[model samples]
Target: MNTPHIAASRRTGFFSRSGVRRLAVALAAVPVALLAAGCSSAKSSSDQSATDVINKLGAVPIPSAPQTQLTPSADESHPQLVAVGSAVAVTLPSGTGTITALGPTEDLPTPLPATMPTQVAGTITLRVATKTGTVKVTTTDLSSRDDHGNDIALTPVGVAQAAATAGGTADFVVRGTFSSGAAQITLREDGHVVAVWDFNIELD
Candidate 1:
């Protein structure tokens, strides 16, 4: 009779339903896979950026505990020594600010701008923060000096200006040679000298 055909149709319907269910389950997994891939890619990119920054700075952040916050002297004749990875409290024109020498860097993407034949000795990676909502730190506001009181020119890289919000911070890099034994880095705010960070350079 036609009973066999009806049974065959029922079997086909059951198989079709099962196949649809399997297809739905596979489709559901796709989004999860894509999300996982995106997260992995983001993490990898972050790690690469960190590595690049470290390489640009010749040395990594000091492993030791951070030192006390340094209060920079207005007197340039005797600037205080600033330890690596230590924070510096500065008085900006608008209000107060902070600068931290994160570490030394040397693998600059471009050569250190120098008139004489000079090699990139090292770089100071700085993190600057200003509570003043409108205040910013620019490369032109900073300068360096050697132990004997000669100017050691600086070439800034990365962020051109550190424009921070009231609670946020920005980072910048300045590479220079220590041929004359770099001694201090001075920061000025609106043509007024505000801070000086001292460094003890040991060449290798």
Candidate 2:
């Protein structure tokens, strides 16, 4: 029972079983490590692709806008003269009106001087007579333009009435200041120019 041959055989069989267990564990771990490495590589590639797309979008450009032009009407060709103490007659849809006076003044009537002027002051007075039904007049119906085709600012100074009935007369006054250049005053009704007055000045 205690023979050397029998003990040598038992030791060899135990060592062989231990070696087989170790080898099986190592073989199973190889697939798990490879799967983890594959997942890491795929995640890195996806992140780099996303970054490339973002960079491409950032490299694009933009655009801008355009401009336009303004054309004058036919009535702008002819203009009336401005003479001291004289009147210019203008025809309207309902009747006619006389631009009775236009001159430079030091003191404007009450409510006519909306703002204190930094330069000389100018005033325009008109008497309108209606032939048919009543005619409506408003401050917006009047405008003035400078020689450079720029609109001269105007403020309503006074008015006798908003409307003039048939056979009735109404008075209106507007005030502004010139900028050392010629100016043209205009009246518009139904989007058409009814009258235009021209004033030329040369200041010494």
Candidate 3:
């Protein structure tokens, strides 16, 4: 005759084993808890009194602060442009040759303090880094979030001119009627994208 032994695992459900688990866990946790609680040295009588008076007070850190490192600057150097009012223009020189646009270049998530009325703006700037042949150019906007109150215009001011100092030019304009708060401006090219710049606007 053989006898079988059934060992019970208290790791079952709460109703079935929670009490045993609770007891075991409490016993195991006491030592660790005491060790953690004892990590700090006892405060002096003066320090204890000072803390006791402000025990009810709670403090938290301010949100959205910039952190820094002890080394070099982390910003990248690149060509950029900024426009104001209804229309502002910047001209970049490109010699007579073929200019191809590079991959999409953009500014990151700019903090918009306000929206709609503030009319936030941004654009990307590109140069004829390396010329290939006679490259045609154009401007296109695909945000599709147009506000009648805010009128932003994208215009190709120049074409592929075969001159000693010839390149293409473009302009972006933000109208006043914009919600008066914050908005985004995205500028694109015919096939490949050129650049993206961001502007934080506020009511003057």
Best by TM-score: 1
TM-scores of the candidates in the order shown: 0.50, 0.45, 0.24
**Per-residue lDDT of model 2, residues 61-172, tens digit only:** 2111211212122222333444433454545555544434455443434555666444456666655555556655567877887788877777867653356777777767
The top-ranked prediction according to lDDT is 1
In candidate 1, position 104 carries an lDDT of: 60
Tens digit per residue, CA lDDT, model 3, 1-204: 567655333343333455455556655554444445445576356655444443445222122212231211111132222321112122223222322222122222356235423433333233322232232233443232233434455333344221222334322222222333444454333322233333434444
Report how far residue 29 has shifted in candidate 3, in Å. Answer: 56
lDDT of 3: 0.33
Q: Identify the superior model by TM-score, candidate 2 or candidate 3.
A: 2
Model 2 whole-model lDDT (C-alpha atoms) = 0.55
Runs with alpha carbons beyond 4 Å of true place in candidate 1:
1-81, 107-119, 180-182
lDDT of each: 0.60, 0.55, 0.33
> By how many angstroms RMSD does model 2 differ from the true structure?
36.5
> How accurate locally is residue 46 in candidate 3, as Cα lDDT from 0 to 100?
65
